[model samples]
Target: MKSPVRVMLIIILIILVVAGGTVATAMYLKHHRHQAATAATATHQLSAKEAAALQVSLPQMTTNLQTSGLIQFTVTLQADKKATKNELTLMQSQIEDSINQIMRQYTPDQLRNDKGLNSLKQTILKSVNHMLPTGSVTNIYFSQVLVQ
Candidate 1:
């Protein structure tokens, strides 16, 4: 009787430990995932009206790549606010120069793939945001990307 009682208590203890660990792990994951999702959405999720109001579209650009080949693209920049959009328009020449400089750093082959294109966009976003004084750029969109 005594042995049986001890065995039962030990089994219960083990079960409780396992259950507690599982619950803790699940809660940890849930909390972290929620935070991550919120952060990602904060940066990317925007209403259509907000996006349209804050967007600045650059004229088509034609430039030579680093190694060889010509590239042409039209970029639309999404600013954080109307003021930022206005600033972007005012600084269009500087932005174009920045884009041209960045474009010259990549080859046609680099811009051909999705990974490369995404990398380019990220680089441009970071560069543009860094240069902004009043407000930042939220996102970048390439309306047209043609690499030859």
Candidate 2:
């Protein structure tokens, strides 16, 4: 025969178990409600806006050489995207000025050399990027290079 005290202890244990189960269920429901709200908010969030800007264009460079003064020679160059076209265009004048300065510094022989042209291309692009906070000249194109 169980003592009265033991019976009371058993009843208390069952009650505690029931209480724990109730608390766990409440906590679970609360967490799920928060998760659902978060999911709904995420679904309503807007996506990022695409950049509708133009890619930077590299200006073509050609040089007239006094050393090879017989005629003018051409060296075509280009750059990859460092910034948008508008950004590049905004700094176009400054970039152009850099190119002219570079050309003026080089002689006919150095201008004719392919290595020299590449070097000039990098320098011009770097200078353009410096002038425009938002854009860079990525390529140097010589669409109509007349080395006469």
Candidate 3:
């Protein structure tokens, strides 16, 4: 049989232990939540200048290379927000024609090299920007390219 004072002391210690565990869990959750929120803010923060830019994905293109092969690829155009959707739609055909003409100039070997690919992108960007009467293209990205 335990003494009454000893039983009371044991119960008080258990309560203190349980309260400490609860406090620790709450603090841990709070710290992790703060970290997660900070990470999300960091990743999604956008500057005023960056918000003004726009991106448009061009239609996938398949054309014959200068050599005995076919080239299939998709391109994304980055431009200013001033370029309206109507302007882009109106120039789609002309853009496709310009890209196809450029594609015909590159052989499979040229398409495979990094330097050659950069040259091809520059050429296509220049040609497309030249054809656009409304807006200018700032950059060209080959989203997917396959030369076979």
Candidate 4:
């Protein structure tokens, strides 16, 4: 029993409401997409030059094997970047001296342990760093270790 004009008005109002909602959703989606793009751009990260400067080289080593006293075990040691090229040339002798002093105390049995070897590597890094002018040997690598 509603009037025809009233029914038409109600339908027009409903259409207007639905259209408003669609416009608001499209605006929100556009804004959120832009925000997401900016966040991705902000996350582009880089490291400092000093942090990247440390270079590691793997050097092989030979150790006397436990059995028969004649066999040898070989290992590779990774060396970190020294303060300078001169430090690398001269530091090896002093670092070798320090390592020899510490290693002489450990028997073949102690060296057999994986954790012990890692600790030993750290120890060598520490000792070598102390002798460098810059006071840091970033790391050590063991590429090919042979124990005989």
Clash counts for all predictions? 0, 14, 0, 18
Per residue, candidate 2 scores C-alpha lDDT tens digits across 1-148 of 5799899999999999999999999999999999999999656522222222334434554554544542233322232232456555665666666666666666656646688767766776676657766534445554443444
Best by TM-score: 1
What residue pairs clash in candidate 3, if any at all? none
Query: Which of the two, 1 or 4, has more TM-score?
Result: 1
lDDT of 3 by residue, 95-134 (tens): 8888999999989999998999999999988887777777
TM-score for each model: 0.71, 0.44, 0.62, 0.46
Per-residue CA lDDT of model 1 for 1-148, tens digit only, reads: 8999999999999999999999999999999999999999677767898789889999999999999799999999999888899899999999999999999999988999999999999999999998888899978999899999
- Candidate 4 per-residue C-alpha lDDT over 1-148 given as tens digits, one digit per residue, 9 for 90 to 100: 5799899999999999999999999999999999999999757443455434544342333434333322122222332333453465556656655665655555566566798678867887777667777545555665544443
Question: Model 1 — TM-score against the truth?
Answer: 0.71
Q: lDDT of each structure?
A: 0.93, 0.57, 0.83, 0.59
Off by over 4 Å in 1: 1-44
Look at candidate 1 and tell me the lDDT of residue 81: 82
Q: What's the candidate order when arranged by decreasing TM-score?
A: 1, 3, 4, 2
CA lDDT for candidate 3: 0.83
Which candidate number maximizes lDDT? 1
